[model samples]
Target: MSAALSVINLAVLARRLHDTSLLPALTPVSVGTLVYPAPTSTVEINPNWEVLYWNTSVYGVVDNSVILECGTTLPDLYIWSFTQPGTEAIKAVVYNLGRGPKIQKIAKTLGQLTIVLKSADVSIEKLLLAANGLFTCQAFYNIDEDPKVHYYYVHLTVRVPVSKPNLLMTGTPVEGSKLWMHCSVDNGTGPIKYIWKHETQNENITNLNESNSVIYVDDVKRNYTGWYHCVVSNAVNTESSDKVWLDIKFGPDDPQIDVSPKTTSEWGYTILETQNVSLLCQAMSNPPSQYLWFYNNFQINIGPKLTITRILRNGTGNYSCSAQNSYLNTSSSRTISLTVYFGPDNPQIDVSSNTVMDRIYTAVEPENGYVALETQGVSLLCQAQSNPPGHFIWFFNNSQVHTGSQLTIPKIHRNQSGNYTCSAQNTYLNSSSSRTIHLTVYCECHLQQY
Candidate 1:
């Protein structure tokens, strides 16, 4: 048993010495009963040697498998080796036997290196930061060939996830103002892509492929205000930064006034006396607005709205609304006119008499008599007191005659002497008052002038 074990150990030692790191010359070896020409000059090399190059950079993460490329395309015998950074020792890992369809490794094809040269690639598994190094793939022809050896190299770097990033802002955050935001991280692998995230108007998260860490907004609006942050990622892992609040401060726009229970007419607003009135002021501001109400240029109320119960005639005037934002120190104002309708009060009727002393005047009365000379002009006027001007209607003997505040007769005749009534009406209030006057025309005829 001891003699057989010694023979097995000697055979393994011979195999190790044959596949050493140094390039070996073509030689002969005997196996059992057959003699084999070891590695001969019969191996041919293709001249397309310039096609292979070194892969200078490759990134990988810990505990992950990384494929390191050996960019050789020639089908010659190959040997795979590795050299750690800051080291001069070259460790042989795998080699292809010159014999047909034979691949051999220094150890079994399992742990550190699995040479898959069918694709000219070496896969390193269960990697560590210490596994980062330079890998070499060497192609060799037979000993008699010119330039018996060529080598291709690749660098492998094990990466770690990026640390927590930091965000920055430039310029003021206000409406219509330009703003810029930046994101940065201290540690991460290169070729890193940055992603920006923000809370939108509806409070939903959105992602942006902003290319760089900097984000630019040309014209900021109110909707741009929200929570903002950044994420940095590579092939390995991704990490997010702390969130930042971006609040935009804006202006108090022009104020608007709305009055309830107010009707609009051809003249203006018509409001009834002893009615409920509500004035609501509206304006857009960043911090909200404080409302101030003005009547006839006098400040009367402070709030967003004003309510007056049992409104009277004194409530009629030019009303103004102003909104102010205390933080922005800005204000906006709007003005409007309110007309309160009340009349028609007592109506007055005045009639002309030939003699001024006997002129008949009546106020809200039934009737009065006026004596006027025939063939002469006479004028009658109607008057009333009201918030809005009252319309006057004249009737003769209770029949509608004319629609005017005044009535004039071009020629006073006997037939025109009758009861004339002047009625005053406030169209908005639907109230009316009237007065009547009767005119009597007489003829003072003498000798004819022909």
Candidate 2:
């Protein structure tokens, strides 16, 4: 064997010779003498040759093709081997030798040369993540004692596009339960990033910045109920998962009551007798809240609101509301007192004897009007029926006598008795009513003779 080498690319010359028949179907091969020292590194290969290596990197996604080159002119013998990721096992996949395993199942010899290397091409067609590994192409030229070999290897990294992620939940989310959301894909190449999304009825969509496939939320609440999904992305592609509804069962909080026809007085909320009023109750709950209304501790209505078409003075009392959550079997309540203001009716005089504590008599009015004896203590009182009792004024014989509901005289004389008038005034209605009593005074001397 001679150690002579040719500078022309023998692979191109071989193609031209094979096409024109300038020579026999035999190919012209390059024979070269060794120059570089043997690589101190040893790779896994059966029947190993001097591994002077030149490595190039290639990246390809799933369903795409990557071309690998020998990087040398035509040699007498070339061997291609495959090494799986994270393994020491080497398999002769495609080679000129007839004794090794075949990569013809997923590979083909490409006719186009590489742009930079100007070398022969072999393509791994339709790459898969399963095919991630190292590919070595060794070219050999036999020259007497020192055999020359060139190793052209490619580090092939395969990436698969992320599939539509499938979102899953740990269980039915309930109040105080820990919630776990998982984004899973049947086929995806990692470093895949996952993002969790929350869709709520009252707010905008929220992105839970969770980078893992699974994320957990401690202590779920009723407000945490919403639609959830996941967005998964890789170097290959980005995809989103189908939506999953997260419903949390919680409680009916304390009820609140709102009254219509807003009016207030010194005695709290007030309304006129003929006014219409409404009481609306509400609470925050899951599965909605059931409402019950009560008046003065007696259940009077159901539902969220109680309406009175024409309320009277009798409609004034304590109004209570209870909100209940059927799922949780919990309830809450609140109460309010409603007051309806009415009138001050016709005033009358009621007489009580303060003259004797042991012997007391009350009379609204006598058939003969009022009579009093001279030198006897007498009290004249006025009364009226009204929501808030009324202010009073007293007049005697067309003259102002007093300014209160009671006019008491310790001693009376012959002329001390006359027409006594009491007037009751309602400040709210701006109305007044009056009643006058006729009184006759007698001499104390006649009573002493009796």
TM-score, every prediction: 0.63, 0.74
What would the per-residue lDDT of candidate 1 be over residues 198-235, giving only the tens digit for each residue? Answer: 89767899887577978988999987789999988887
For candidate 1, report its TM-score: 0.63
Cα lDDT, model 2, residue 204: 70
Residues 1-450, model 2: lDDT tens digits: 011111122243334334321111212221132122122344332242243658677777878777777765655556565655555444555555323323443333222112222334566566666667666675655423334556676777778889998988896577888988888898877888888888997767998777789988888877778888899898889999998888898768788788898887766678778889998999988879999999999999999999998899999888999999898898999998889877677777875443322211337433436656777788877888777779899998989989988888888777975678888888887878888777766675755785
| Candidate 2 global lDDT | 0.69
**Which pairs clash in model 2?**
none
Q: Which stretches of candidate 1 lie above 4 Å from their native place?
A: 1-131, 135-155, 266-268, 351-379, 408-420, 427-431, 437-450
